[model samples]
Structures are given as C-alpha cells and as structure tokens.
Target: MLGEMHDVLHEFPDLKDKINELHDNDAEFAKLMDTHDQLDDKIRGLEEHEQPVSDFHMEDLKKQRALLKDQIYDILRGLS
Candidate 1:
C-alpha cells in the first residue's frame, strides 16, 4: 500500500483521453484533479516517511483519497 499509485491517470488508464479532455476544458474537473493530487501527495509523504502521521490519520487520508477517486470515476463514466 505504501508504494501504491493513486494518480487519476494511472488508476483510470482506459479513460486517459477523456480525463485529459475534461481536465483541459472543465474547470470543476481540473479543480478535482488538483485536490486529488494534493491528497495523494500527502498520503505518499506520510507513507514514505517524508511526513509523520498517526495511523488513524493515515487511514482517514486513504478514505478521502478513495472518495475522490470514486467521484472522478463517476465523472469519467458520465463522459463515456
């Protein structure tokens, strides 16, 4: 789990083109991506020891990351 990749592009490789399209043209989508990226970086930093975080806090961060991923997936699905 520590080394797992959660970047939207990697998580949804099949939707790469659509993801890029929306990220470029949709302000909301772009914002979501920015938030997701920030969360991901935070999680990674915690896991990799770049940042210190309690286990409970890390779990909460993982949950938030998953929720954002689901929201992004829903948008991608709607585009299909």
Candidate 2:
C-alpha cells in the first residue's frame, strides 16, 4: 500500500518494547533506525509517484530496504 508507515515498531510488533529500549539507549541501533526510515521514505516516494526514479533505481532501493530490515531483525534477535 502507498503511504503506509514503515517504522521499526510496525515492522517488528513483537519487539516493540525492546525496540523502544534500544532506541533510547543504543546509539548504533538508533542510527540504523534513522537510515531505515530514510530509505523507506525514499522507496515510498518512488512507489507513490511522488519522486521520479528509474526502475533500476527503484529496485536498488527495495534491495537496500530488505537488507536494512534483515539487519534490524538480527539486532532484535540478539536483544532477545
């Protein structure tokens, strides 16, 4: 869906509390979250036609988002 929120909590509902805790205390985790958010926004913009980008560029963006999501999941797993 276009314009859907893609925040960390939304991506990992089960780790809501841990995500909040890390966001408050872990600098690296916070930075990763920010990067993930920016990537998500850019991808959404392209998807919704708000930003013009080549198909290749859009695919690259999606790949980056997937990598970030995996990294985030790893962090969350480590926190468990």
lDDT of 2 by residue, 1-80 (tens): 77677867789998989988988999988888889989998777777776777889878877987888888889889942
How many clashing residue pairs, candidate 2? Answer: 0
- Candidate achieving the largest TM-score: 1
Number of backbone collisions per candidate: 0, 0
Point out where model 2 deviates above 4 Å: none
Cα error, candidate 1, residue 68 (Å): 0.7
C-alpha positional error of residue 4 in candidate 2 after TM-score superposition, expressed in Å: 3.6
| Model 1: CA > 4 A from native | none
Candidate 1 local lDDT, 1-80, one digit each (tens): 78577889888898899999999999999988879988998788777875767789888988998988888888888942
For candidate 1, give the lDDT of residue 66: 91
In model 2, the Cα lDDT at residue 15 comes to 91
| True-structure RMSD, every candidate | 1.9, 2.0
